[model samples]
Target chain A: MSRVLMKGNEAMALAAIKGGCDAFFGYPITPQNEIPEYLSEHMAKEDRVFVQAESEVAAINMVYGAGGAGARVLTSSSSPGIALKQEGISYLAGSEVPCVIINVMRGGPGLGGIQPSQADYNQITRGGGNGDYHLLSYAPENLQEAVDLIKQSFDKADAYRNPVMIAVDGLLGQMMEPVDLERTPDSKQRERKEWATDGDAGRRGKANTIVSLHLDPNKLEEHNLALKEKYDRMVENEQRYERLETEDAELVFIAYGSTARIARSAVESLREEGYKVGMIRPITLWPFPENAFKKLPDTVHTLLTLEMSLGQMHQDVKIVNQGRYHLDLYARTGGVVPEPEEFIEKAKAILKKEDAA
Target chain B: MNSDTVYRPKQGLTDREFHYCPGCTHGIIHKLVGEVLTEQGLIGEAIGVASVGCSVLNYVYFDCDMQQAAHGRAPAVATGIKRVRENHAVFTYQGDGDLASIGLAEAVHAAHRGENITVIFVNNAIYGMTGGQMAPTTLIGQKTTTSPFGREKEGTGEPLRVSELLATVPGAAYLERVSVHDPKHVRKAKKALEKAFDTQMKGKGFSLVEFISTCPVNWGIQPRESLDWAVENMIPYYPLGVFKDPEKEEEDD
Candidate 1:
């Protein structure tokens, strides 16, 4: 098949379908409207189910139900819309119904702006909804990686019976990239899903129940512990990141999603000037790449976290770094996109200040 | 030499005793749903979405694949399940607080989308599970814990006529409002549920049967008196009978 140019929003929509998604339920929201619009146009042509729900709240509930019933489902929105889905996302996580959700994020804390920002990094990685739950979250820096991760997330979701979120900035969703739109579902792990609510007709005379409410405190505790165990396993196996030229670097730039791209540029320019700087880009934000903190050269004495938010992922870096190195944040918040020049200047000053002290 | 067993508990209902208060019509409504599922042979293929409130435990009583949704979100949940398994009999059981108040958008939107599913709404006029707050269906002048001085038409406005509102949606294939206070109305309710299920089986569209019910404990009255109070108060505000039926309408055209 020939590669075709596609927008990030539409690419993720097509990716889910290629990964065996049976239904799409979502509402209209900015920087990601093309996702629902594309599905609304093509789902019927493909004979796939599509519903433009009344609100993000209803859309996520539809996703929860559809996912509970053993169908591969998908939903997409931006920051404000994603906030509306928090309550239902908690339910989906609690019920352990596998589905895929995409947050092509915009500036936020509340109605911040409809522009590219990493403000939702904390919200997506930290469970924004109530309760002790963690969804496998991926932050891809480019359109290709976004499509690739989302395409693979559906099966991974089923393998664990959990929801997987793809968090990107508005820029990725709006930009166009060339990709092969080949629809192929994973044949491995095609075993029958016995846990799905596919009717009691085939099961041996017993009803299936999908619920999140554990009324008795003891039972609820048990459920919570079980979820914790699942998250622990995810941490052990799913942590992912990309490290570049950090062996002899003095300061490492830590970032993810859109900011990671800018950080990469900053590192490249610093390297040309013969300054000791490198980059570490986290692909999976939750199940965060703690392994990146395992071994470090003596020359690496500082960790610089660059983000579009006001220092969210810096917390994660500090938690893992555990004071082994001096940690700090260089961020642009509320819809401000940072240029590589500011990072080059900040990194030189922060490192020069360390030397002077 | 054995005689044919003509009558027995249908496989659609479990043996567990209901948690509903004594004299509440929830048990009656559950039985009617169970009976209809069995009669139509849809029991094995049924998936019920249990709402919050007293019926939060409805999953345990319905002998089919069941899901318990967050308060007022069962219709949306049922919509999800039905979209995935179109041939399966999917239905949602919701109370006034769960259906009319917080979940009004979910309910109305599901109907507007013409989602092929069944809804069994229990309109008891007050929130029974939360200890008698005035619900959307609570009578205009009715007294409840939240409406101690009785509801004021000038303040909270009139009680919501949920069944009538849903009937106006073109996607709704069938709509009915019935009560379980008397034997005649009980029989009528059973038929309404059966018809709603049939509408889903034929892939017609959305169908809902709202049961005007009672809550003795929350209403501050004896169980028997609550039934009389419902007949005297709720019946007139939310009248009984079908508001929309797709087959009949198509015939008229």
Candidate 2:
């Protein structure tokens, strides 16, 4: 492993290469374009394929194809581009292809602006595309976490036989941080071509059909039910969350991605100001850290949900709180990231109100 | 004769039976593709991207790695797959509406970039999956659900001739349009498929074969009569011939 300072987007591309990715397919999009630009220059040198597909739709489809062939493949885009990829992502999920998708989220509902925002929480955590499926969504708050999560994303995608998304905000994608570049385990050292479309030369007797369509309504339903079962298994096995000083705290700050980064700063500042404020940051947004919130002590009086989008993830926080605690929502959208000082002020206010009550 | 001795259809298809209507050319086309994969020993290395439309369930019939693509996005997906696993043969099976309508950008760009992939375009004139809607390839004065008053050239514009249009694109290496209404035409289409596959194997860029097929059920005609309709009405509008053959052109050059 070698230490290097790298931007989140550049680190993700390098991580994909280190993870033995055979292809990188993408179109130009804000905040994440650095990823594709880096791969376009380096992938061919590594004997990997690189394509600047005409559109995000094409780039994602390319990922679907390469993934079906059992190659570690990836595609990255910002909000608008990711919207175009929803259909392709849905197909990959339905077909049970293992691939990594990186979304350096920007503000959106439509061409929202090229700034860091966790506005895509609903689209990422809930199914972004059509049909019943869940992406293993990893939210990285900083550049180092971005590289680490991307490397782990490939393993999780293959392990679950589903698409894994490294959902970082534009802040993380654009920021530079110190990271130790670790080489991924060689592909030869791992399980070789057991479930891929690598020409059935020696293993199977005949060609294996990989398809998501079972025209019969009954069979399709069964396939979907099986997918639900797999999702349940993922929820049970892959839930990850972090607690910062939540042990005897009166108020908990619930956030993720960049918002969690701001919340962490606020937690530190409030602790210095002598307030019992802590933070719960979710690393996996899909298999959300519901149990972590549930484990909070009864003395935890208020839970403040901070996000870049208006009240998207607050619903999840409320659901986990289960009416046991009062829920407060604070959000800034349209590419505006909440300042750490602002979050600290809000935390102080909530604690003061709690004391008065 | 015993049931086993009788002339039975190909065993490559699933026993589940297709939902395609009787006399539909999709079943025949599927059989041809299956037979080609089986014959060429390409089944293991072949991955098919099924397009949106009547043939969405194509994954069920083809005994290879099959992926269902959004309307017209098959070519893009095939490009991605072929680029990554260059050793694998990738192809897209798309219909008229899916290819010429919403997925036009993907189809055109894939051909323009000379991506080493095969596209099997099925031009059935009308949208069969969505209850006979007017398609980008709907013939002049052809009446359907969306074009109840008939497809007017002035308002709806002329039907797109994809093979002719694609042949002019510099990136396309081989472009052919064949009809499957007759046995001879079917054989020609299969040969075209073989050539397309061969071109990819040889690292030749973008090869496309457009099949003029009959959607008898959606045409509101008897399945047998639909073949005659395709021959008389559809063939003249969309002619049948190889527009460009790179190997032959190279020989001449």
lDDT of 1 by residue, A88-127 (tens): 9899899999989999889887888998998887788889
Pick the lDDT winner.
1
Residue pairs of candidate 2 with colliding backbone atoms? A62-B80
Give each prediction's DockQ, rounded to 2 decimals. 0.75, 0.55
Under CAPRI classification, how is model 2 graded?
Answer: medium
How well does model 2 score by local distance difference test? 0.85
Docking class of 1: medium
> i-RMS, every candidate?
1.3, 2.4
lDDT of 1: 0.89
lDDT of 1 at A344: 94
The digit string of per-residue lDDT tens for model 1 on B145-219 reads 999989988878789998899988889999999999888888899889989999999999999999989998988
Number of the top-ranking candidate, with DockQ as the measure:
1
The chain B TM-scores of all candidates, as shown, are 0.96, 0.94
The parts of candidate 1 lying over 4 Å away from their true place are A1-3, A180-189, A201-203, B1-11
